[model samples]
Target: MDPFIEINAIRKGLADGEYSSAEITKFYLDRAKKLNSQLNSFISFCEEQAIEQAKNADNKIAEGSSGPITGIPLAHKDIFCTKGITTTCGSRMLENFVAPYDATVVERLNKAGAVTIGKANMDEFAMGSSNENSYFGNTSNPWDTDRVPGGSSGGSAAAVAAGMIPIATGTDTGGSIRQPAAFCGISGLKPTYGRVSRYGMIAFASSLDQAGVLGRSVADICLLLSQFGGPDVLDSTSHPIPDNWLSSNPKLNPTKPEAKITIGLPREYFDQTPNLKSVEIAMRVFENAGCILKEVSLPSTESAIPAYYIIAGAEASTNLSRYDGVRFGYRCQDPESLSDLYQRSRNEGFGKEVKRRILTGTYALSVGYYDAYYLKAQKIRRLIQQDFLEVFNKVDLILCPTSPGVAFKKGALSENPVEMYKQDIFTIPSSLAGLPAMSIPCGFQNNLPIGMQLIAPHFAERKLIEWGHYFQSLTDWHKKVPELS
Candidate 1:
């Protein structure tokens, strides 16, 4: 019943007949009840259903039919709709909305026998860098309650770090998964865009939105990915299945000599900030792993932030138009007409930050501005993708800080939208390029964790995870815990 055990350890205990799935499920539920007040992580609780699923998993295991993740506890960001679960997406607009079916990711996890604890909070419609934008309330960092847990996947990261659950799911449109993972000192991976199906997961920017895993360790994440990854006919974007990613390949030796492996450092990413302490820690880890660091130019990297804002906003503006109060989302009371209902429902339901992005997106995609703004942004996005592809020709992986710095105090960027967006500078480009990326704790500065990001080319997550695994084995940063328990 120890909440601190990693997923593998728990699985081993279950396989050894030390605990049944029912017992493991109760352990997490009790821990969640104990911690939810302080962490503000889950949006809803699925206790009865989770227990039922866990019981089924126990039966399967007794029948000698269990898989790696069978009976493991799992949580999903609210953005991924689970049938009959109140999937608010952390917005008042959908406060009472329950999905008719589960998201592909949720369905896969269910089939794997992972018990769903509940939906985790997120930025209203996944728009901000900090959890402050969530209508459900900000998720406090377990490391320091006064500081923010980076978002829009902050709740997912916080849940895992706080030990409410060992593994959770998150989506990264830009840096949603990685940034929060960095702030909370957890391991998160944003796979290449099409590596996992997105069907039934609420849309952000379709082209950029990707499903990923947030877990206590690199190994935990790898196991989750093996279960949730691969193609699904329901989602046309899902890529074809590849060889087993869980097994290491002989050709890719993560511990090879520095000259044999190249890790790129984009000068632009560094020059954007004078502080290299976070970057410095990551470099030391790479060196410790025998990686040869090379300074490479991703010249278009400077345009990433601006380009990301335009394209993501435009897509969001179009996608979010469905929540017009006429559909399944929240509706205004006593509306005189349809227009009145749409305006009031949205105005009242959306949090301030979500409203701002909607306005920004509408402006960019508006008739007169479309050609000059949205179209131009798409062009820049193409250039950004090209830059990464070109850089990959010379390097096996790219290393950078997940955030410019560590987690900030809750109110730090509340009134400043630009400053909030800047927190995503190092993360957006990878999402824009549909590249697989991860954030792993490198070290701590001022008692707060710093995350180092690793990005690999399309469908190259195996390599990225391999490199991350090697780095994590040599460093104990991932093992550090907040005194929350």
Candidate 2:
């Protein structure tokens, strides 16, 4: 079997009995084993457990009880808690940690009989725009080992692109999922806020963090969303399942071909980003797709990175307070006093980046600075969301380059944190607006990949995927695999 085939193709093979679930699992396992040393895509592999699950899937097939995801091979980001498996969130603080329960997404995928190959690496506590913050190691882009895959979900994207897994789950806060998928030349969607339950997933910024799916094509992404999206009674923020994503989305179904899809080109995103060749490629791809392009203005869009940093970092500071060396995570070897233990444990356990954000967040949300910085940033967030809402009223979907350019060489942006934050300028608005958005590979730039982003209104993931599917049908960008082929 060609390991890079999308999820739906594997399903077709399974339906015809051409490949058993176990065989499919082994295919991905062998691929992962071969490439993991070079790519460092996976933080941990559940090889034995994956085979067991595959066997159970085969048993279900034998019993004539099949589900949409039965026998499929998928992976989870290290951030998503998997029962009895390590859920490190790519931070050294929890490097030895294992979750007692599976995250809602993991549980759902397991119940549907999907085999989890392993936990993909990510930015430490989902912090950086690239995968370099990882405590385990940096994830190398499969396309060019010297270049970085996007982060903090870079591992998930690189794994799918390298044919190590059919699909993987990712969490987007800012541009984590979309940007990385763009860099790796895969398809990834950041569903509307509250679209997927957050239960058991490590929190970075509760309001901004969203769990999403990454795959080789739009169809595979849609299939995963249909099964995992919707309200979970366990999560208070979750909403009722939106209408059937695939059937109702006109872009996915061309029954109404006359319906012209409008694509918004945000001038601010292009103007502020460093690269234009990649952006030009994306614009050409959208124009080729028969999309009507219009210049849309979102004046406050430029401030997104600053506002997002304040908000996400502040939330992360609060959310991560529980890891104060007292609980189940890494602790100091010996301590003379309680305060000494608290300081020493965290000082030893946390990586430099996580600690930096913690200090920044804690200070920003501090008593005297709360109203000045944190509260003001929240107001700015409202303005950002309003800008998106107003723009969506003018266009069916907003199109932009997912990142300024293709993957950068490792250590390229390591020293300049501010420069790294700028890479997300095009992607942070949707996260701020709680909208449905996706990154689809449009073409290649200097052998690396460039992703064109599609953004839809809240609960309109169907629309985003529809346009994505239409675009994929026309172009072969998503079909391109890494040299690992």
Candidate 3:
């Protein structure tokens, strides 16, 4: 088996009997254990469970029964609950919490035959932009050990980049998927809100919390989407996407005249984010591909940060209230009173960042401030959506830098919380509007990867995927992997 082979090769190799599913599964598991000490990506390794599933997959393949990614090994962000497995969500609150059931995303993928490698580490309750918030410890970037691998989904991206796994699950609420994908130099797709089910995924901000895929390329993402997308009765937010949606979508072959589409370059992004040489090279790649770049302005971009914080914090405040020691989660040693238990458990379980957001959200949703904060932020979110809707009228997609700059040193923004929030300045607007967006490796700066974002209208993931596939087909940016030693 080829060590660097991605999703497509793994599937084909399995079908052709080049190697048994057990062989491939063991290969990844071995590598994950060997490299995890350096990257700290996986909080839990399901080696025995994975090999058992792989054995089942081998039997199925012998009988000629398999799905697209049958026998393919992947990882899930810690936020997704796995049955009988500890769904830590990167916090001590749930460090010992064993879920009774799998998340909807996990269940569907399991039925499709994708083997689980382990539970990837993430920010506590998926709250922080950097994986530094994980109670288990920080996940480092594969490119540079001292630097961050982006956040919330950093463990997923770092693992994939270092060749520990071919694909991983990610949740994007305010740029978690795309930003980390950029930082790790992999491909990540954050589908429009409700495009994928959120049941049992351990909610952060329910309204903005949507699961996505982080992997080698757009083709890999499309294959996963074909399997897991569409309606799930378990989640009311999981809307009905057409069956076999990828094949049904318009072809994005750039060579054809019909494939010609206008791409929008947001002027707001240029002035605010890091205008590095990599950004210039990325723009040139699009221009050289015959894409007509037109200047587009999302005037409301300036307000995305404040609005996203208010709204996300408010929702997070409500969702996290469930962990107050009474039900399951962590319980204090001895509780004299119920209030004491709640106070002690929460303070001990949650990290600094999680506590900060909870406080912010609680205040925003508090009486006399609800309308002034949460309600107003929701209105701002609408304006952000309208900005994209109007821009899409003239352009097929919007493209910009995934992050303001390349991956920063792990402790760079740790001191100043506000500085860390700026990492998602370019990504938050798209999340605010619940649009389909993706990040693909574009260039490198100071030995770190830089990512460019492609965003489409709500549920327009096909177009976003098309452009990502086309770009990756012609460029080797996504193919370049970090040299892990």
Candidate 4:
């Protein structure tokens, strides 16, 4: 069995009886278990449950009742609640927490018959740019074990890159999905805000959090996305757009004529970024494809980092208030009073980065500072959104580097929080504007993968898929898998 087998091929094999779903599931499960010690990509394995689901999928296949994703194996980010599985959100606060009900994302995927192999590790409470914030320990990049896999979706990205799974679920509160995808050399999509249901995915920043997918190729990401991307009754914020666009196989029309498509290269992005050799080479792939490339301005790009952190922290402070020791999460031992219990439990259960955000958030939302900080940040967010909207009027899509540079070594920026936040400078503006964006491996820099990001207008995921699929066809970057031993 090819560890990098495409999902469509897997589906065909299952249907033709070439290999049973059980066989594929076991193969990935064995691989994941074997590599986990070195990569620490997964927090828990659903070995028994995954095999059972695979058997059931086999039955469905035999009866000709299987759905599109039936028999496919996937790993869910720990942030998403899986019934009876530990949904840790990469924090000790929920380390022992088992969800009683499946999250909407998990529920929809299960309905499509995708087997859950395990829960991927993530930054604690989905905080931080590098996976180092994860309470379980940093998730190592498959390309370079000593370097960080971008977080909080790092584990999902690493698993796919390491060939432990063909596809996995990820969430992007800021650049969580795209950053890790860039670091680990895989395809990751962060759909427009509210494009996917977030009912059961642990809240990072309510307005910005979105569940997406990570895979070896954009086509594979689309395959898993079609199963779960759509409005859900449980999440009020979920957009009502029909998901029919995702169902179409991108491979059918591999290379759409690109002459009419206008891709904007943000002048601000290119000016600030230092190393552009790999990204420059990638732009030529587009130029050769006959796509028009124009320089556009997004002046608000510089303000994105400040605005994103403020907004995300504020929301996180509010959402995480429920994790008091008095509740179901981690509790301090033998507290004398409620206040002592709350303080000690949170201080102990939460990680250093999570605590920092909570404190910053609390201060921003405090009585005297709300308007001075939080309100101002919201106003800036509107400007950021307007900037993208303005640029969209001139260009069909926006192109930029996913990160300022390739993934850095673990703990490289540990002491410099501000420098670390800049890792997401290129990816945050899109998230703030609630637009669909993705990271595709474009080339390598110093033996590390370099990712180029594509941003489309709101609800324009189909366009992104079309262009990204075509780009993947033009280059072998997305096909370049790390030689994980």
Ranking by lDDT: 4, 3, 1, 2
- Span of 10 residues, lowest total lDDT, candidate 2: 247-256
- Go through the candidates in order and give each one's C-alpha lDDT: 0.87, 0.87, 0.88, 0.91
On a 0 to 100 scale, what is the lDDT of residue 447 in model 3?
A: 74
* Global Cα RMSD, each model: 2.1, 1.9, 1.7, 1.1
Per-residue lDDT of 366 in model 1 = 86
Local accuracy of candidate 1 as per-residue lDDT tens digits, 88-175: 9989988899899999999988998899988898998998888888888988999999999889999999989888999999999999
Better of 2 and 3 by lDDT: 3
Candidate 1 achieves a global lDDT of: 0.87
**Cα shift from native, residue 444, model 2 (Å):** 1.3
Least lDDT summed over 10 consecutive residues: which range in candidate 3?
249-258
Best-fitting candidate, scored by lDDT: 4
Which tens-of-lDDT digit does each residue in 361-478 have in candidate 2? 9989998999888998899899999999999899988988888878999999988888988889888878988888899988887888888888888887767876778777767888
lDDT of 3 by residue, 131-180 (tens): 99999999999999999999989999999999998899999999999999
Error of 4 at 36 (Å): 0.6
TM-score of each: 0.96, 0.96, 0.97, 0.98
Q: Kindly give the number of clashing pairs for every candidate.
A: 0, 1, 0, 0
